[model samples]
Target: MAPRILLCGDVMGCLNQLFKRVSSVNKSAGPFDALFCVGQFFPESSDQLDEFMDYIEGRAQVPLPTYFIGDYGFGAPKVLLTASKEPANCGFKMDGLKVCENLYWLKGSGKFSLLGLSIAYLSGRQSSDVQQYGVYSQDDVDALRAVAEEPGIVDLFLTNEWPSGVTNRANASDVPAGLSDSMGSDSTVAELVGEIRPRYHISGTKGIYYAREPYSNIEAVHVTRFIGLASVGNKDKQKFIHAISPTPASTMSSTEIATKTTNTTLSPYTFVEKGSSPKDTTKRSSDSVSDSQYWRYDVSQKRQRHGAGDGDKLCFKFLSSGSCPRGQKCNFRHDFDAREQYIRGVCFDFLNKGKCERGPDCSFKHSLQHEGENYADRRPRSENSSSKRSKECWFCLSSPNVELHLITSIGENYYCALAKGPVVEDHVLLIPVEHLPNTLSPSAEHEVELSKFQNSLRMYYKSQGKQVIFFEWVSKRSSHANLQVVPIPSSKAALVEKIFSLAAEKLGFKFVAKKFDSDSDGRKFLRAQFDGNSSLFYVELPGSTILLHQIEDNEKFPSQFGREVVSGLLNIADKADWRNCKYSKVEETKMVEDFKSRFQEFDPNC
Candidate 1:
């Protein structure tokens, strides 16, 4: 059974009243293990000073295993000074502070287990002043971020400040329209909460109780619930206290739970190695054919038909593949500089004469090399090693080092391939033929082909009594784009949009949704609909229910965020880790052949 915890916000040194209230509530509340108090635990006025000092001086005793965050109030410095002298209160431990017999103070930031629940906290308020009781420092944020980076689940997260933009998420009568971001709200807090993706996010000091819906974070498989509490002892009786028992970590995916091992090893999925690697572009390296080149869940292959590219277009094979079949008859540019310029996405005219008339929307790399910077010396691994990015980029079609036999179908600008590790037999990836940074950057022609591919899959899935879903995580930096095409049971298809919106709202935000009048006519909607701020993009329930999220600078965006959602929706979350779903190459090949035969009628390219 999960432990029941009582959460209160901003006691304001009203310990006598706070405990009295806690006791009254606990009478029927039944076996509450701990009471966590946020906001100002110190007395705001002199009237409560004498009574607050009584507990510190041993004249009175705390009733339960009470934990408080606000440590700066009238009589706090003097009283806490004495407690600091005790052996138990020594050092900078985030936990284990002996404020009184049953009282504990969560100083600074740290994580600890309480009643089998993992609790993380950043105590104190947002302030630059070092001496302020509620003042949270950069050091605290830094320490908390380190904890959040670990692979696991935090059952409960406590903060003195609310996450920024939380109030704008839900429509509540108490939350005034256009209420300025709360003074007690911190964007850093929101970023960390997004990174940690805790089950429950609790905060106080704003004096309002807002229980938000569970939101799916970018990096984490689970959704987080944000709850803000009102100031204790406030006359309006605004809800100052909340209670909840967390679901056991065992119930969650292993990828979502943190273990107690000392191993701090990094996985290739999250880590990017620096420096150049030895490779020969003279010919396709034997390493490319080896399975060692593949990262977790990497999948790519091409079904290039004859006479596809324009006669004037550049041939990537002649430039990087070390050989060309057409030889003198090849109509493509074979110059190294021309190919490199193309790879960098520089406008061809700009490369030729150093000028481009199309401006920013030209969809080309537009940057000048600064003087004194050695372009050759600082060339990225992708440039130095011709196949490096393609070899590793699962969505790069030019890479011969892809899951070759997995290609299902090929369209004009897009193609379909089996997911490297699929939960469902029909799971597939619809990827762009070009190395566009993300889904949001697709050009008009690319969008048209993509829509056709989606429509074909949607129609086919409906005929099969299933629903198709398309989702992708759009990165701010360069990454080959692909949309996850998953087919869910028809019964649950109707619930996908509502379930996602409800989930997004839990993290104190909402997913802005739009529906196109028709699958083919959606030309201008996305060119401006998704601007610079947007990071996540998806198409649910076929070509409808388009959703996007604007990412923050500090947000932790997961590479496999969309797949994690599908895993949960299918109720096989344990297999959410792609590693668990891996099959032998032979098995994968056979599976591909089976899917190809079955997908013939619905294959748009076919």
Candidate 2:
């Protein structure tokens, strides 16, 4: 059954009147599962402190199961601080604190399942000074964004302040009197609501009632209804409480849920440029990274170049940022594959300008491998040498050059080794025990063990507040396969896809992106894409986004492509080449020991 819920505006310590109204409604409307309060649940004046303490001190009872945000005001600091210190309220508890029996304080920002309904909320107003308890931080805003990316619809979103531009596209008469154009709303909340697309968005801070017309959300099947209520017992007697009994989205069929009303209007949020469509603007804006070290691309025109094009000549504009103004209509070809084939065995800048400026820093092949002492000659023997035998392969456990101290863990068919020139701390390599050329052809037993190690690393890194990315380059050469595992800051997780896409554009190639449920599924998909015979590169990003590319037999693809992209994401492009990031034997051994000690609990082999 769908849950019956009651939503209230700011109480401001008017508990007697609020519950009197709630009790009258409960008796008539009878049983509501829960009452959710927005805006200031606590009072702003000391005069109402006695009445507020009645409920907090258990002298008076909360009429129903109540959950509330807006946890700031007169008496809130003392009350909430006391609740936070309780051991029962520790570590991300969704049900929140059992504040004086039936009342619950939904502190901070989070999403939780309430009687099958997905309820997400942000407590407190936006402020530059996050040290104050009355305001939300960037971390809280970002956490909700991560929640927005999760599957399923948000039944309700509660915020303390109004989303800026909430009045747009609404009937003028519907807006309450004396409301300003801005309505003192927060743009961050606006951006969040646009992303979350909750079925109902409720807020209360201005002490005025405004029930907006249902508006359509970008890329969503259902529409969102926004309602801003006035404070409880306001002088104007504006509506302060709303009743809703929405069926859980999980129970509704897609077609039924997609059904829209005739009153639906365009979203009030104008997030992009004037001429661009909402979907196009969303894609580009969502992929953008603010880091100064990383470059942004013109993703708007990227799709136009994906269609059929003529000639093998490279499009210079497309080569720089993955988009061409002329697109397919351009005389020159805009294909990354064609550019890759053309640039093989030659430096791209050198080919275009008749001279290369990067000198030793350039990663591209200035000359073929057969040419004496090229860039390939300076790489590690394990990665670049032609030794095909396990006895001679530098990565092999039996090989004399294999660093025994770097071996951290060993499974039935795979072993973990610290990267010789680590791109980031805790960066490790997963290698097959057998003399295997690539991971795709590994047996089922080997594949399972590989997944265990991947999961183990993921858990260990997550505990350190970091996210891990895995990438591998498989070629027709005799060298063994080693999947590079690099740890990145959790905050930069959103930038991984954008940085890699930008890097791919600069290098004149596009990676085929797909979602997979597991590492096994990812490998199977890659094998199918290449028909099990081609050299290919793939990156398993922070989440479900897997980027794949096939290497042509004659193509001189950079073996360090994965590392280069990750280094760029980390804003340490100097360490893209392993040779430049070498450590002394003592330092390397210390790193190994530190990693092993920290990783012991998560190791499946242990």
Candidate 3:
């Protein structure tokens, strides 16, 4: 069985460094069985975060399981990476108290579970707040009490925050003297831990504060500190391990239940070569140092020791393969097959980006080639054919004067069209199928489908080396969901100029150059003139002091300001009415004039 090694700390970018150190250590200590990653820095988005998990898992590919315990979003379901099943997006609640077998996400807090306590409910607040200070209200206390009473439960109470104290409240008579005295004034988490001692406690917060010696009731206390390992081995031998040296070398501080030997020597792997032995005072003809100065591991002692004798022993053991007559193998031969294989597997699995020779038989399908093949070849023909179809009007099913093509097809009439413009490729317009007023809420099913479609389209376009600018406009006048797409320009200057020109011509907005004084209080707003009418839009461009605003008549314009704003920004706009245009024009015109006047007032010497 692999050694069950738990790495608990405030994990930052130390994962890569940790793997390297672990690899070096395994040369002697051997490979650990399981790795428990306990702390914050867990990625919220599965796509964004999987790289780190994959890295660790890949390195320790020798069936050494790993598990992560941390805070996740409420109602966010656990993602099962092993089977590629649809991830759970609901609250974090465990079906069973113990998460047994394989890589698992032991939900930290929230949700209804018999054994697991929702830290949010217990704290009478969100999980985030509870994690920061470990504070809990009265209502939260009640919820915790109810969960504690549940029978036949082996609960390893996990929270992103640590409790004020760690003690057993269930065994009232056996309660520690310090905890019993402080019970009344103790916080909710403290009281709960004092009453019912869970098997394990993992917190995301930092700091290490262990009670005095003979701390047996509590199993293991993991805290994030600059100090090294503090207390180890759960409740049994509660020894506080402090660094003999001043500063902490690792992020986590451990307090062991018992004191262990402190070896200050760096591992043999970390060594600097010297030309010759101090006694000899003679350098070899070759620049490289002789094997005498190199560090070597002592197999019998199971530790790294320096000098010639050590290297000779290691060389014989390794070179002779334990089969030489009279046991005359190389001195440094240490048969560490298991450790070498485990380390090799981990490096090959996670660190290396080589393709899998076993193909489907390989556990980690991490090859970029596989991803490309899956995305390109595995898509359904129907979806592919649909993508190739021309853009037609959602209402008339005929091509518009704009020579529009439908990019997003949400069934027959429900489609989003794009107008191909010379300046911007595939300038798009989104329109709904049925001619209903522009009030539409995408159904959950629609959202899922649309999101997936959008992602695939973006990926496909990106793979093909094309850039796209997506825009949407929904107007109440025509019960059509209008969406627009513009092709992105290759040159930065060209793209900006193109967008500015397009917005000025089509949307009656203009981009102007203006300067502001160093002490100017307000940003300069631009005046957008269109159709003998004008409005103000804020623009804040690089190397310019003016704020660019996309302004339009709120009431008098044919298009709603909201819709126009979305279109101008190349973002989705909410649908709104354009009925009371006449009433809105007076106020809108004044607003634009006022903004333009302010810009002129702030003009340099003015």
Off by over 4 Å in 3: 1-7, 21-32, 43-63, 72-102, 109-147, 151-157, 165-186, 199-204, 207-606
Query: Which digits, one per residue and each the tens of the lDDT, describe model 1 over residues 458-563?
Result: 8777778888777776644435667788899987777777766755654445677777776453435545656744455555555454666665433434445566
Q: Assess the local accuracy of residue 84 in candidate 2 as a C-alpha lDDT between 0 and 100.
A: 80
Better of 2 and 3 by TM-score: 2
lDDT of 2 by residue, 1-606 (tens): 779999999999899999999999998996888999999899989999999999999999998999999988999889988888788876556566777889998877888878868789999998876666667765466457656655567889999999877775342236655687465588778778987899999999988888888888765668899989889999989899989999876556545767898888778764454334323323323223221101111223433675432233344434433333343344544533223322343554443443455554333445532344332112233553433345455578887657888899998899999999998999999999877878777777888888899999999999999999998887644257899999999999999888888767755688888877866687677666755456778888877668988866434355567887787677665466575578998999999999999999999999
Which number leads on lDDT? Answer: 2
lDDT of each: 0.64, 0.74, 0.32
Q: After superposition, how far is residue 368 of candidate 1 from its true place, in Å?
A: 42
Better of 1 and 2 by TM-score: 2
> In candidate 3, how many Å is residue 10 off?
2.1
Q: Which residue window of length 10 is worst by lDDT in model 1?
A: 267-276
TM-score per candidate, in order?
A: 0.44, 0.53, 0.25
Residues 389-430, candidate 3: write the lDDT tens digits. 222223445424222222324343345443321123333343
Off by over 4 Å in 1: 131-133, 170-180, 250-606
Name the better of 1 and 3 by TM-score: 1
